[model samples]
Target chain A: MSANPEPRDPAGETLLSAAELEARLQQIGRERYHSLHPFHKLLHGGRLNRGQVQAWVLNRFYYQSRIPIKDATLLSRCEDLELRREWRKRIEEHDGWPAGAGRERNEGGIERWLVLAEAVGLPRDYVVSTEGLLPATRFAVDAYVHFVREKSLLEAVASSLTELFAPKIHEERIAGLLQHYPFANERTIAYFKRRLKEAPEDVKFGLAYVIREARTRAQQEQVLAAVRFKTDVLWAQLDALHHAYVEPGHVPPGAFVPEGPQEWQASA
Target chain B: MSANPEPRDPAGETLLSAAELEARLQQIGRERYHSLHPFHKLLHGGRLNRGQVQAWVLNRFYYQSRIPIKDATLLSRCEDLELRREWRKRIEEHDGWPAGAGRERNEGGIERWLVLAEAVGLPRDYVVSTEGLLPATRFAVDAYVHFVREKSLLEAVASSLTELFAPKIHEERIAGLLQHYPFANERTIAYFKRRLKEAPEDVKFGLAYVIREARTRAQQEQVLAAVRFKTDVLWAQLDALHHAYVEPGHVPPGAFVPEGPQEWQASA
Candidate 1:
């Protein structure tokens, strides 16, 4: 057997020349995001049974719940008003503001996620509390927050470059889930609908921020590593889901488990 | 399938009383710790061929190297000079005083661990650098440092409670390694010999500190959880070892693997 391979040197060049940086960022997402994860394939391809679907929704809700917190962490780190103004929109999108005329026009991504969770038969309170999520998920999510808090702002923004590929994955998920799971309709898929437009705009803004800001080779490498780490965070979540749920009988102790056919509704 | 089972209340009275707390801490070690790990059993039993042993030593040196750092974190957090004095012994034990004619004992636990590494066919430089250890190993070890730094001083002391069980395991390990692995002998087992005497004394001091400090039930629970978390840290190290070296073809990307079999020689 061979020794451990060295991590690729993303800092060989003096500068990534903007276009190269963007391409490199996209390449990382292409090669490593959860969209490429096998569990995601099984999820979007109508292959998993109901129990497996339930497990995915339940586990993913934890991830969904943490997004605003991660974004808020990034918000806390930025010194620029323009950056904060742009980033605060993300938090607002996840937790939308109230509209006038006694109607809330935008109910937020988190609210939409709860509807998706309900479609998969999870209790909204349990989904929101995220007490049932895997330890790996918690670690992975916390690692993202720690990354933002610890790393350079360029790297921190680069970590969000996964958004570069999210729109396509969001579309695939919406179509796949709608076609396969009868319980999942347009209202239940509202999260993806919002993300499809929102992700591209977010990616455009974050990419521009990283490209313009990452001036040194070391900073560029940090950006790449941050993106790679964020990818690992996403990949590990899928790994935990696959190991615990899809592989039946390998569930870790004190992790969520799908109830039997007779007891599913009662457990929910 | 069944729903997720609740964690059983570790069935017994609160380990509030000193004797009961000591017993409960020992029970934690009995249930956890690397001695009970499958990889440890294989190594001590001679079931692992030479290459596996090499990988074990190489990966474990990462852990051996971190003990002082974790202790120093504890020392830094402590406000009382007396407590720091006691904790300083742990640092001194792991990182010996400077060398000279009248110098205090110069070689430390880290040095002795290098001898163990040399016995198992790893180069001292490679062992010291920790260049090729598993990502999971780094995560687990860093998590320990984070625990000590972030948690209450009582919880930090409780994490060190694993030392209370270390003497028994050290004796078992020393006997088993000398009897089973031809490359291992008295010189190589020196680290374990030192630990046999050191661990119990260290644990006595740590337990007293934790018991006196952890007055509230929440604090007590945090202490218990810290031990469990520390146990997970140790357990995760072995898990990485088993996955990389023992279970053929299961090594995750970017981890150590032994080279061609060759006797490691200690050089001046």
Candidate 2:
């Protein structure tokens, strides 16, 4: 009966001031980040058991594996060589150079993640296979990849702006795991420790890119929504984990069956 | 260190009998369908208040609108015009024939869904705009379209086997809604009324296609996996709804917030 409403802009609203925009962005991060999720609280507070922690690591590896692929998609679409030069570093950081392309072979984030997965007692091969992922995990992470591929370049960069809020979660995660979980150590939880080093640089580039480019209120709203969408992406994964693993009898068929209470005693 | 494991067939396992395959498919549906989701249980049992029902209608409208598009994608890929001819009827059933076509204009499923939405007190304009949708709803529905687009033809067709299990849910939905809710009129719930007539033929054709064509054990497994994936697609949408709406205080920042408990006391 009615048409799709055109995004109504008021008569003469001006662009957001830089300080105001940054504050609003920070406000979104502080309120909506996955660090606030109860599942994360359980994990970081050492309230989760061994299998519950393994469920998180195994399911999370799927997300970790896809990051470089998403970055490559970003690089393919970018027109700026300088931006591409900066962005491609992300791909190598996730997916190390394959021993040949005129670069030294070194480990990347994905291998580091597998090491964490292995340390957490998920077989590295099983982690790589991704056969144990929650179905929602696949849908949520694939949705992120598609969002990067389909949304505007600005939104793609903006989605990664969740990194602006990542350092604190990483710091807490490292300390909590080290303090509580037995499998966790300086070496076992190296990925989070390394992320303290990697994520800030990513956040700096992504935050500045969005802040500089999202000039109009409409574009700024899209940036905010993208950041929100990314949080939902992270939050949804934890929701699936909590529903399937923490909550009894809810995991759909074929998802990983963590050995909680009965099968695997509380070893962690 | 190891190869991607070839799907191991036990040394002497043979193709399943058609009856066994059908039973397995039914077993999957029994266990995994959206009818089993608590959100649907609450909905059919008339426990959700006005805003909660409105949230369901609004978010589900996005999925309804995309059905014809996914169906069209399936038709475009089918080399068999016979299959295309059969599938095009589905597109018309959802999208409806235009007024100028030789056939008299009859309302299709999407418009009928809007009417159901209107009957439940959501303004048709708001439902049409779909600005109130859960981000997970968009991702899950869009993933269905992508699954149809990207998977093999048999798998694409097989993903639709959820329809095999749909009629019972539709029957229950129609009966439950008419029995429990105030807005129960034959005209208002016409969408589900129509689907009971439409889906059986679809199930017949699709069932035969998978059973007749999936001659080998491996192909049968793919069919089974596709059906399970489809179930997850539907289940994930409800999981999102239940997480955001059924559970208190978990709705993401921009999703539809239903009037329930304190705001709109139980008036269903």
Candidate 3:
């Protein structure tokens, strides 16, 4: 992300209070968050047809599936045991716990995303294969994983600060999908539901870490920029979705071409 | 690129002859290259407005500037001194020869691209800063660099096979820009002109290397897939340009927004 360091923002205020920094970060969400994108508006308002919805589900799975990998990448870079232990939860959350630790099976967020994919009439294998994804989607998701791998741990943790804003989107997604699409039963919408429960705990840790670790104005700026960069990652995916599947729609060769009107298919 | 291994192509043919492998590679370029993209058609056919052209030039600078880095990365992975000697030319060609070697200063492909940007009324500093680039552009370009870094040396070399089809595009661009856009002068289009001279040599070596190195059917498949991946990297960039600068264009926030109709400003 810092391939281009932006000229510093012109707020001549020297050091930011934790409260001041939180306000600035939230301000980024208020203005630059993915919810403000037209595609999300089309999505939430029931304006998208079944095909567009299916395209979103298929493409978004790439991001969903990468969550654990990105978290693991972050955890690999952190030396602190506390941070590593907390971060391990993200990997487990997406990838799910393994067999027989004396607990019920957890299929994790990714399998839940696949269930949603099935609801939208896409086969789970096709969604997992990601061969149908827009090159733009792959690029955006990979850039994100790469960002977490390469950026400072401060910036990497800051990137996840978008989660600070995620619960709202998940809430909206839950309501919107249920209201607009026939396929959105509790079983299919489980990913967003689970995220709503998971993210606040994650965000509480991340925001505190970013605010505490930033200690200097420059670090705060990097933290802020990392959040902005993550928004770009999220936003660019929808831009690709809109461009390919929405107005003047030209699905790039090999991306998922929405089939004839989709009928809800239960995940096996 | 291989996060999801594509089910192998079902061709039962054993190993391919050099000519047969070359045919398959050309097939990818013919069917999937950026030249086939609508935005490129708009570009070469002179349908895009000046601002659109500026946006393309600005965003493309990210790709242009990263070439040397990508080449250097490939070289770092390669152990064979002969291969390293051959690959070093790519870095030198893109980065240009240093002055201490008793040669004229060649500011390289990136500088030439900025000249093109300046011809379309962008400032050199701003274009070089990449501040105004579409996040989509950054993602696509960074993904390419990342692929070269992480993938096998054969795959990395294979990715550069797009240069095999470069001459035609260069020829078309030179003639098309000069014929249609007022900004298209020899100085402004110097990048394409220079690449026409440089690419054949690079392609000759890269193509021969890929053809010779892929000794098995599986290796050949990876080589072919690498080229396909390269094409996607390119086509996605144009997809982004069209989405943001073409019809129903909502330039994603933080991308280069085309300005008031451009009047060419000669690079100083």
Candidate 4:
């Protein structure tokens, strides 16, 4: 798992071999990913009140709704059949494939997140509308979309390395939300539960592609920076939530103000 | 200037003529542009301290640096030679034309920003490095880049309608920065000064294009949404700056923290 502990050569000014570059990327995920953010800690720990949690869910829907679009942008830009074939699955996964002529459940992550939104008591239409999510959320998610569309293909693939760290967060979220919030249940947390399986597969393909393509030092650096930028995209969203809903209470004008009475019983 | 005050048609179902759509687009700029953000109020009124000013210059550099890239994305996507010919000038303006094909002091907006960066006392390399800018700045600017790259050609043209509002802001900035800040001079503020001339030309073309192309109500609505999305992109960056550098001071972890001593009376 430790691909290369030291990613430098004797000359020290040039390329790290693929394994070494992978190791460096893992280092970035460890240090910079939003799993370490305080908002996640607060959410997972049952510390945030219902309104605050609603704020998180509403803002996060903005991110969730955009994932397939981001994936499609990636797929559109890839020319190689094999790469496109592999990447196309991501779009199908986030935006579900047509139900096999036999199967009934043909929903995707966005739908699953909406189930969570309903469980959390937000009207489904409002969540879908993304009417009042934080300005920061829109900016952060749109930035991710832009990053995928504009960056080099290798760098675009490299940015998805955040997936390498996502499974752990999903694991923690599944356990934590189930224990901490009454509304959290098998159906409600399905988004995170499904991601636990989906993300590792994604990271496997993405990490290998980045390691294989980043054949030079400049490329390795760009790959690393792309991952770092992706982390910032995730972290900035949490910062916006924390600043607005958590402390000092300075929400920007016209963002979602948490509605409904303070507490909720477990929904059936 | 008021092209059509009422954009709605008698049937209330479809199509705004070109003038009506132009008026609606201008109305968006009037209401939503970042020129209306309070951070700009502080920035132009000389209320921000030196570090805050430096932060604005450095962060805005990320935006200035990407303008040509966004323009190039537009050019790459365009099929029309005449449109590309007109748009190529924008890319060249941000990234200066080739040297000694003619002129002296050939500079792009990026370099002009560095002049402001230097006048504001940031190291040019540091400003260019873009290491310490707010995460929000990256998110906002990247959103604009993505907006240009992925949206419909009509929507892409419409988004640039923000330019229609730019000349007035540049005029305000020139007068305000000069009167309020010692660092302000013709050379340092050249970015704004030049834009006053360039933007009107860009706007003339972009406005005509959006107005002429958005023939359907649905298209007009998309055009309006694109401009509003652009305004959000601009406003979100200022919200990030204000939250971090101004009152209640919860600077996000790892953003630029002002290091310079506070208050400046004419840096002779």
Candidate 5:
């Protein structure tokens, strides 16, 4: 197989109208994104044994910690105040307000994410510091930042269209976790709850921005490509996790290793 | 492992003196660079049969095509004309001049590399277009370019210190290819012969630049780290190739596959 798919007859025809394009984008998420990834299914299904669950939470914390910074990078690059103001909400959502504003309420998404980490039995410092996340996770996330920095503004905005499909997946994931994991509860899953609400607004703004702005066929194609790249980013992380924690057990040296029965106490 | 190694101990004794650092860096190349990688061993040892060698040349062309562009990026960023002039030689060495007074009669390293591609049965147009290279090769090479752009100048120069070790590897690779592959001869291996002389001068300039500029202990460590990062860049390309082309054969969906019979075709 060629590393890239044979260039389809991209010029053949418009496969979908604007409305259909939007649905096709969502369909891509339904079929290909992390929610459908086997590791994620195993995660939400509670089929992952305890060690696998620990691995998921530990690896995911790396992604969570980088969200605000990635958003802030986007925030830094936007010249228009309207765009900046809209984007600032994402950073604010992750970072919350400074202490003692009385407005400085409970912790933000990052902190809530830590609660999920603790619920899964990972140490707070290790989780917060992201000391043991997979290298593939770091590489994938860095690739996203590079895309945003290097690609056109339309494509950068389009890449964030992953948010468009997020609310639905967020719903499924939360419901699945609650149904399957006794350790998971409404309180522990608060991060997904907030995202379920936040994602729709973000996605609505971003999709409108992309649809209106991606004027040329090439630009429209880039929009689709960006979302595809983002999907791969999410999918690759799960693939690495499955390869490491599930089949064949050929984890790279220095990645997280689950402690066996005797070693479990020492790690604990 | 931690994506980044922990900061080295402040008081850790020096592993190599200034001169010894040069020797150890060369030693690392001797033991670990891609020339020593099993994929190269197969290619140079005549063990790959034919289609595999074509795949090797096709994938490697991506690396060859990027070197001058990477050097040009480094040149563009340097403020000093002397530094730029010194660096410009690398670009010239790889790209050659375009029909000018000092222009060499032959095409550049890129053109020479295509001879290997032709010898191994890949079309020159396909090789030059780089449509067939692995995604991992592009990612790794781009990562190296970004590293040079973002790093301190001393560290950036240090990254090219890999050249210091390249001469030995080039010699070994050349001899190995000539002895083992009946289709490979002086003309087919012209690229390595050019690199044999070019790499040492480039290495000397880079090493002296790094040693003279890396005054503090922290800066020295950064230089060392830069070399290691560059080594990883080269190492990862081979790792990706090995995994995709060799054992387990779980080639990613669209990567290149050998066509027709496995035996070498007689050169025209």
Candidate 6:
């Protein structure tokens, strides 16, 4: 939205200063992140019902389950030991180290996500199997994986900067879920509670890497586009969710359906 | 919506009768096709202005132009000469044969689509280049291509059965576009008018192929899921359009933005 002719140089400078680049990256978050999506607002505002929430948790597990693989794809592509060392921690966080192994966190995000799924009264096997994921969920998550695997390393790292915006959503989610849903205790929503801490750590490294690496004007443009693409990946999942589970609800064929006493009554 | 305990084998039959299968396919269309999407309703009912209609055409061109490529992928995977012979016509219809090379139709759907794009006032090259497509558009179309490439042959064929419902929507679209938009004369809307005659040819073959090949309950289930998947591909594109162009529009960072006398003033 800036009046600058060059998209990369908003200030019309030769190269963006690190603070400027970081500001642009944060601007992408403010303008495009899924937390700003209506579904997210509905979610954090506690406007959705249990079945809708359950549908979200179930579909989101597809994305949550794929993070480690996306990280692993990034790790596979990078040549720098220092970057790899910092990045390997993300893989471990999502996929967890072995039980007896000396890692900071032994229980991966996926396991914790399943815990939340069980708390939502979904069968654990169904959530873990991802049998009931929306087609949109699968496509969006797979796009993230392929984007990391295929895009330039700078772009890949930049895409991960959505994590830059994740902690606030996590905080809001924990508060909203606990206040509104009976299932939202520390044990069930621990995944988000942990993400409040973990995302900042991950994005700290990812943000700095993209800012430092994307030096050229064209590279900066790619980095910006990458972040935008990531935001779409996240936002599209919610669009699908809102369409299927929200008002005028036409749940897509073969997706999760709430059982037992009709938990979802479309709010008029 | 059926109360059957088992999703498949509703009658405890080994396989559905062809009539029964056709009915089920139509049912899927009634419930899930993009025709039922709010965007579709908006477009057909004259609720959307020219800019929104242009956005739909432009984004949809991404899907429109890729039909041949998707068909060729299906053709490549198929070993049956009869099936391949039938399928290759789809590619020819979208991409067209070399001018005067003796193909029935020289101007393909893609060219016809550009006519629609021009009628709507988008620059022809911009629509053709697909530079303005939403990330959601690219991802959803790419997912369809991948679905055809990777799924079982029968599933690929089954996904194409969304065309079964196409003639009706095309008829409705032609009527609505002609009635509402001044630019909707036959010359500008040739794409839909052409599809009215062409889609039945495609779906007639596609439907029969699916019913014949999906001989087991399990195969029938896969066929059903494939159609559902196709509907999601379509419904997701409109969701992207509606979210980006409709009320409280948060057009994702780098997607299409309508230019010219700003016709879109978001409804309160």
Judging by DockQ against the true structure, name the best candidate: 3
- Model 4, range B1-268, lDDT digits (tens) per residue? 7665655545565577776677887888877788888889998898988988988888989999988989899999999888899999998888876567456655887888899999998999888888898998887888788778878988887788899889888888899899999999989999898889999999899888877776667777998998888888887888778777885555665678788586976668
Candidates sorted on DockQ, descending: 3, 2, 4, 6, 1, 5
CA-lDDT, candidates in order: 0.76, 0.84, 0.87, 0.84, 0.73, 0.83
**Each model's Cα RMSD:** 8.1, 6.5, 6.3, 5.4, 7.6, 6.8
lDDT of 1 at B184: 76
Candidate 3: residue pairs that collide: none
DockQ scores for all predicted structures: 0.16, 0.44, 0.75, 0.38, 0.15, 0.34
Best model number under lDDT: 3
DockQ of candidate 1, scored on C-alphas against the true complex (2 decimals): 0.16
Where in model 3 is the C-alpha error above 4 Å? A1-13, A98-104, A262-268, B1-13, B98-105, B262-268
lDDT of 1 at B126: 83
TM-score of each: 0.80, 0.87, 0.92, 0.80, 0.78, 0.81
Candidate 2 stretches with Cα past 4 Å from truth are: A1-13, A97-105, A211-218, A260-268, B1-20, B98-104, B212-217, B260-268
lDDT of 2 by residue, A1-268 (tens): 9963533335344667667777888898888898998999999998988788999999899999999989999998999887899899898788766677687776888888888888777788888988978888998899999999999999998899888899999999988888778788777887888789989997888878887887678888899888888988988888888877887777766788865352323345
lDDT by residue (tens digit), candidate 4, A58-162: 999999989889989998898989999999888878877566778665588888999999888799999999898887899888888878988899988888889
Colliding residue pairs in candidate 5 = A1-B254, A1-B255, A2-B254, A2-B255, A3-B254, A3-B255, A254-B1, A255-B1
Report clash pairs, candidate 6: none
> Over the stretch B48-122, how does candidate 2's per-residue lDDT look in tens digits?
767777788898999999999999999989999888988888989998766775777769999999998987778
TM-score of chain A of 6: 0.90
Residues A1-268 of candidate 3: C-alpha lDDT, one tens digit per residue:
3553333334543677788889999999998899989999889888888888988999999999898899989988889999999989999889987669797778999999899888778888888898899999999999999999999999999999998899999899889888877788899989999899999999999999987888678899999999999999999999999999887458887788877855444435
Best by TM-score: 3
What is the per-residue lDDT of model 5 for residues A24-52, given as tens digits with 9 covering 90 to 100? 78877776666766677777776777678
Candidate 4 deviant stretches above 4 angstroms? A1-23, A68-108, A129-139, A142-157, A197-222, A243-257, A262-268, B1-23, B75-108, B247-255
State the lDDT at A72 in candidate 5.
Answer: 80
